[model samples]
Target: MKEKNQWSSKFGFIMASAGAAVGLGAIWKFPYITGMSGGGAFFILFIIFTLLIGLPLLISEYIIGRGAGAEAISAYKKLAPKTLWVWIGRFGVLGCFLLLSFYSVVGGWVVIYTGLSVSGNLLHASADYADIFDKVTGSAGITILGLLLFSLINVIVIALGVRNGIEKANKYMMPLLFLFFIILVIRSVTLSGAMEGLKFFLAPDFSKITRESLLYALGQSFFALAVGFSCLVTYSSYLKKDVSLPFSAGWVVSMNIFVSLLSGLAIFPVVFAYGYQPTEGPGLLFMVLPAAFSQIPLGGVFLSLFLLLFLFATLTSSFSLYEIIVAAFTANRFRSRKIVAWITGLIVFAAAIPAALSSSLLRDFKIFRKSVFDATDYLVSNLMLPIGCLLIAVFIIHKMDKALVREEFFLGGTAKASLFSLWRFLMTWIVPLTIVIVFLSMLGILK
Candidate 1:
């Protein structure tokens, strides 16, 4: 048997894990959702649920992975040999596959826009942001090209192996992600009318709170940290025994929240300052952002920087999604990791073609009254993710032994009985129940 790989340093582990957690969920989706879901109130609700739900599940995944010292699927077989708990890992890998399909479609849009920004074509004083966005999404050639290129990037990185590949890529990219974020925030907040955007994003308005806002806020927090899927579990599997799970989890969560807040500060100020609405989905990032940036001095240059920032965040997240799927098959493999990775990339690129054409050639096709891209997003976000999370919570609380959980959790430090109890309480009761309610609401059974 071959020795399992370990992270070169604790910082590399933190960055890779944080890179996994911070992607479209934080920068792209969170800002638009915040705009639609009561702004500051929704932001507050999201933070509350992140602590309650996201953080615990993150810790549980680490405990499961490091405790068992195996990849995602085998981790289950190692711990709960005779039972069907292994299905959870299978489900998570499947979820990631479906996620990356549509996720790559959007990633392609970022690629197209980033290149356009470089040519000074996408953002200019006379450019129409809405038309540019529409053309990009509606053009099959452009969308497919973007998706293919993005998929190739993911494939090459995964082929290079863990330490020399995922870790090294994130170690530089994650810091650049933050640096670009800070620069954008500084530029955005300095614009006239920026204070109004700040107020909308930071000042909680109880009056604007709605049932939908609460639901989205909770769901956003749960999904935003990249916990429902088994990607983090695979990443943590590479960690050394001496690394502190709690401390590492803290850094990932903190990075997630901080990046989310920074995205809001970066985008909302620009949206408000430019007198534009904070629209939802690709429109916000592609349309509204371009329009806002176009109004700034040398906006083309700043827009390129922001797009590059967006590309880095998207790639970092895609790396984890690709890693989990490759790890699933390549564990104990005779075939090369490179071969498995290229095969995985081809599968994703093929699956994502319809999603990339959702706004164009496939515009007439609908699943559950939604476009392919929208339907895929809804399925993963609303159905697959919540179910995956619920199973994880149940497995941790019901199947795993308490002593083992405690030992894995506090392995490098003294056990805090209070923290253990709190985690147990949430996993045993709050986490599962909350997921059930949210799932019910998504199905229109609760409201």
Candidate 2:
């Protein structure tokens, strides 16, 4: 039998896992969604959900992967053999495939924008940034090329294997992402009328909290953490046994939330400073941000850096998505990781073309009253993730041996026995019930 790959260090594992968790959802979607959902109130609810639900589920995946010490599909099989429980892992693989299909589309946009920013194409544009955004996304050549390039980047990194590729890249990218955000925030908050944006983002308005927004917050928490998709399972499978699961989970969650808050701080202040409405939908980051950056001294330089940071975040997440599929197919020795990564990257790129063209050639394409891109996003975010999370909670609580779970939790002998019971109760009860309610509510069945 071939030896399994493991993380070289606990820090490497945390960085790689945190890289998976902190993606476009945190840096791009979170700010705009917060702006639209009434800022501080939605932000507060998102944090609450992260703590009460997302954190436990995160630790759940860690336990599942590290305990089983296998790929996502094999992990479940190892834990509960000769049963349908492995389908949870299969569901995760499918979910991740569908996820990256659209996710890469946005990632491609970031790649294209990064290029445009570097070449001064986006500088001092007097026209509406919305128009510029449309032109870029509407071009099939640009979009497809960008998607291919972005996918290629993912393939190259993952092909190097986990420790040297994923871990090393994350160690640098995560800190760079933070440093860039700090610079943007400093520049943004000093602008005239910036305090209003700060107020909007930090001051909770309870009236903004509605059923839909609450549901949105719940979903966003899950999305932001990259839970329910078994990406974490694959990453954690590479972890060493000496690593504390709870401590690792705490770092990922805290870093994710901090980056989210930083994103809001960096974006909203600039949006208000430029007198643009915060609720500009999906194009807020690509469109409104360039316009805001155009107003500052040496804005072009900062804009380029920001786009690079954005692309870094997207690529890190894409690495995890591709890693899950590649790891499963490779199965440690079936095919080389490089060969599998190339094949998988090609498939994902080809699959994502429709989504990439959704703004142009496939503009008229519709499924279930949504465009191809929107439909895929909805299916993954609204349906697949919640169901996957629910099943994982059930399996961990009911299928696994209590003694094994206790051993994994208390490996370092730091956490108390009472805390293990609390975790089990949350997984068995709170996590499942919350996911089901949110899933039903999203389906309009709860009202």
TM-score, per-candidate, Cα-based: 0.94, 0.95
Query: lDDT by residue for model 2 over 1-447, one digit each (tens)?
Result: 232546788888888888888999898889878888889999999999899888989998988888888889989889999999999999999999999999999999999999989998887758578788899889999999999999989898888765677678788878988897887788778888899999999999989887668777887888899999888888877777788898889999999999999888888887887777889867788876787678768989988987887788788888889888988888858688788899999999999999999989999989998989888987887678878888888888889877777778877438877878888888888888888787677668888
lDDT of 1 by residue, 105-210 (tens): 8888889899999997787677777778888888889999999999998898788765776678788888888987787788788888999999999998979887
Error of 2 at 366 (Å): 2.7
Instruction: State each model's C-alpha RMSD to the native.
Output: 2.0, 1.9
Candidate 2: global Cα-lDDT?
Answer: 0.85
Against the true structure, whose lDDT is highest? 2
Q: Could you tell me how far off, in angstroms, the CA of residue 305 lies in candidate 1 after the best superposition?
A: 3.3
Model 1: ten consecutive residues of lowest lDDT: 1-10
Q: Model 2 misses residue 352 by how many Å?
A: 0.8
